[model samples]
Target: MTNELTDRGQERRDSILDAALTVFVRDGYHATKLTDISREAGCSVGTLYTYFENREELLAAVLQKVQAEIGNASDEPLEEDFNRISYADALRASNRAYLVGYRANAKVMALLEQAAHLDEQIYDHRVARIRRYIDRNRRVIEQLSERGEIYPIDDPFMFTTALSVMISRLAYYTWVEGFFDDSDETLERVAKTIDDIWFRSLGLKTD
Candidate 1:
């Protein structure tokens, strides 16, 4: 009985997170309140508190939810299957996935940026999560280098970190910048920038 209750409670928590993401994206995080999320989730404020201690925690939960969704389709092993594909192609493929994920969760991404400014802890966690993800894929990057598909770099880990941060900034500007709306053209530009950086950094020509 206790286990069932716990599971149900968790489900409710997840639902609240989904609703919260929508609200945050629609209204921005600072403008959003627990009451707003509760109403959106079809739960009482008290019920919302039963799962999350505060708005900050709720935002974190929402961010985690978005991250999970973004990674859902990224579970395939790195494309070491064939040796013919250029390193630029592999990098482009990975970055295209990122652009898709960002588009899918634009609202959540906006909310996360808003939350990061209001709370130091949240900001730190967001940075750490990004760095960790890059580190996790460092080996795949090195493997591509080994295949001679891409050029080798002095420190692939740091290169990955820099690349991640740069792409994130590109997405932010493209999506949130005033008078500069995000579009397929902008996404392609960002992808090209990434390819250029990777190609040059690895001593590979853009040809």
Candidate 2:
């Protein structure tokens, strides 16, 4: 929907999306208003309408932006050559990256979960998005097994799904629910624990 905008127009649209995210995180999706976003963006409600047809469209755009940021945050680990690095190190790096991304988007992710319960479309999108992560990681596990870097698994897909769910729940509790302090020490401890699980489950040597 934003394809035809000039560079300045696109910038304005991006600002609106950022503002929407801030407001949504602060006041929540159901409680947020276009005027709140406009105020945060230092624009008028009319200007917001210029970028988005309604509050729903604006929110969807904000959600898309958040999703993109989260995706980018963890992409670096995927590009690493596992042959050059130990599998345990790679898994630790990947887990830390994923947790960092999840921590950054924690509030918005929680908001997304709330929206999912109320909106079928959001629910479906959330489910599909998680499945995509599972599928991607399952492929990675299969490749690592084929390379004989990890033990052969009878059901890599299910195993990946389980690990993904465990990590996701840990992130939700640690970040969204504030189960632990957001300290570097805490992050390191959590990452190491996750690494240990992955290494043990895959029968990879940790030392």
Candidate 3:
């Protein structure tokens, strides 16, 4: 279905989505209007409607674009050989990947979190997304524990929830907003601090 769009059509749609993201970020979901997105995209309201049926669809498309750009990178299946790497290497690799991904997409992520609070439908979507990640991590943690690589977590789901919140809030505060210094050194320190916390909590050893 996505392949049906001609290049020009797809470009126009993408432009609309980009504009929608800008308005959503600035004015938030409750305050943003479809006309605002159309104006920002330099398209008429009718044209915008041709691309997206409603604001919800447009917002969903915007989030899908972001997930494809930021979240999908690490969602790729790692090779068997990659999984064969040492426990510590795996932990550090995954943690580093998250820090990099979150840093790169902090603004869009913050917007997503903000939307979750304003709308019940969006809140459900957010909860489902987080639940998916938590389930995956719980399985990974179970595998690592079975392999005797780290301390067994009694409640992997809860741990994943906590870890995800910590990272999300940190990314919002440090990168999206200007609460913390987002310099290279500080990002490095922040990532290291997360790793330290993970290691301390999970009883993970050095590489």
Return the top candidate by lDDT. Answer: 2
Best by TM-score: 2
Please give, for residues 1-207, the per-residue lDDT of candidate 2 as tens digits.
555999899999988888898899999978998889999999999999887888777777777777767766665677688668765666677778888888878898898888889877677778877887787678768877887878888878789999888877888888888899988888888888877777888887766
Residue 24 CA displacement from its true place in model 2, Å: 0.7
Q: Taking the tens digit of each residue's C-alpha lDDT, what string does model 1 give over 35-149? A: 8988999999999877777888778877877776665444332454545655456566766776778776776776677778889868986887687667656766776677675
**Candidate 2: regions farther than 4 A off:** none
Top-down lDDT ranking: 2, 3, 1
Error of 1 at 99 (Å): 0.7
User: What is candidate 2's CA lDDT for residue 144?
Assistant: 74
Off by over 4 Å in 3: 1-11, 76-80
Given candidate 2, what's the lDDT at residue 73? 61
- Of candidates 3 and 2, the better by TM-score: 2
- In candidate 3, what are the lDDT values of residues 1-207, reduced to their tens digit? 244778899998888888998998788777989989989999899997787778887887887787665545544432225456765566566666666777876767787777888767667777766676666566667777887878767777888778767766776688878687778887888778877876787787776
> Hey, what RMSD does candidate 1 come out at?
3.4
Model 2 local distance difference test score: 0.81
Q: What residue pairs are clashing in model 2?
A: none
